[model samples]
Target: MAELTTLARPYAKAVFDAAKDQDAIDLWDQALAFAAQVAANEQVKVILAKPGLAEQRKAQLLADCFEEQLPEALSNFLSILAENNRLALLPAISELFSLYRADLERTVKMQVSTAFEMTAEQQQKLIDALSRKLERKVELESSVDQSLIGGVVIRTGDLVIDASVRGKLAKMANAVGS
Candidate 1:
């Protein structure tokens, strides 16, 4: 995981820069996502791993897999990856590129897990508060886990706020132990 991130950073940055210059952030996002999906398939992974497969074949196969949906520029980008034998890094590159896109758009993704469904008003209020607190456009994602018993667990990037009943119980147990 770390090695893939290290190897993919430059490529992702380069693609992001190109997208910025072209005013095509969302366009590149869609293209990279499509390419990443192709690269992640089991049969495609096997094909990419074959040393005997020529670069042309690999590029063609990927382009065909996308049903030629790739723009000319992205098609060329795929050729570059093929030439550099970095096709396997597409998934990491896509993930990193999305981070770049989010940063450029001044957006942060937040996830909330709760024991019960959050009302639309409550979700909106939380999003509003989080936007003000984080100083970024908040994209709220949420799920319900009945085992949470009550309250919520919120996560954004590396930060987590564990306010669930289970979390409180664990903290209480720790305090008693201490």
Candidate 2:
């Protein structure tokens, strides 16, 4: 995974820079995501991995999967990846591109897990607080996890806030043991 990400970083950066210059960051983001999904299909994987296939043919296969014609820049990007035998790296490229886009847009995506479903008011309040604290736009994905027992656990990238009842008990247990 690490190696694939390392290999994909340059491609992702190049695509992101192009998108930025074209004022089409969001459009490229979506296009890359769609291309990644197509590349991940099992049949597509087999086709892409065929040693005898021409790079242009492989790229055309991907382009044909789209309902609409791809922008010329993205089509060329796909051709480069196919020529380099790097179609397998599309998922990593898409993920890296999203990270770059998020950084540029000053947005953070967080996952919040709670013992119970959150009310809209509660979710909004949390988003408001996190936005003020992180000083960035917050995008929240909420889920119910009964194992939490109560409260919530919020995660965004490398940061985690564990306020759940289960987490507090574990901390207390560690403190007493120490």
Candidate 3:
């Protein structure tokens, strides 16, 4: 994971710089998403690892796949990855690129996990609470986890609020142990 991040960092920075300069953040995001999807596929991974395949052929395949959707700059970026045999890092590159974009936009992503599925009202309430706490607009991604028993666990980047029953129990146990 560390190596992947190391390999992806420069590419992500370059893409971010280009996107910012051209005012094409959305275009770069879409292209990166497509490239990431391609990289995640087993067949594409196999093809990318094949030493027999020419760099031009790989780039052509990428171009053909994204002909209508990708802009020229994004397509050329994909070609650069293919030439350097760095296509496998597309997913990591996309992740890093998203982080950079979020930094630029002053937005944060929050993961909210609850014991049960939340209704629209519940979700909105959580979002409102998080926005008030974080003092920023929060983009929430929610999930259901029966293991939580009750309450919710909210994670925003490195910070986590584990309010679940299980977490509470664990905390109590730790206190007793200490």
Best-matching candidate per lDDT: 2
How do all models score by TM-score?
Answer: 0.94, 0.93, 0.89
User: Worst 10-residue stretch by lDDT in candidate 2?
Assistant: 79-88
| Cα deviation of 175, candidate 1, in Å | 2.9
1 versus 2: better TM-score goes to: 1
Please give the clash total of every predicted structure, in order. Answer: 0, 0, 0
Tens digit per residue, CA lDDT, model 3, 1-178: 9999999999999999989999999878878888788778899888878899997688777667765856678778878988898888999999999999888887889999999999999999988887797777889999999999999999876799999999999999999999
* Candidate 2 lDDT, 98-149, residue by residue in tens: 9999999999999999999999999999999999998999999999999999
- State the C-alpha lDDT per candidate: 0.92, 0.95, 0.87
Name the 10 consecutive residues with the lowest summed lDDT in model 1.
64-73
Name the lDDT value of residue 119 in candidate 1: 95
Candidate 2 Cα errors over 4 Å, as ranges: 175-178
Q: Considering only N, C-alpha and C atoms within 3 Å, which residue pairs clash in candidate 3?
A: none
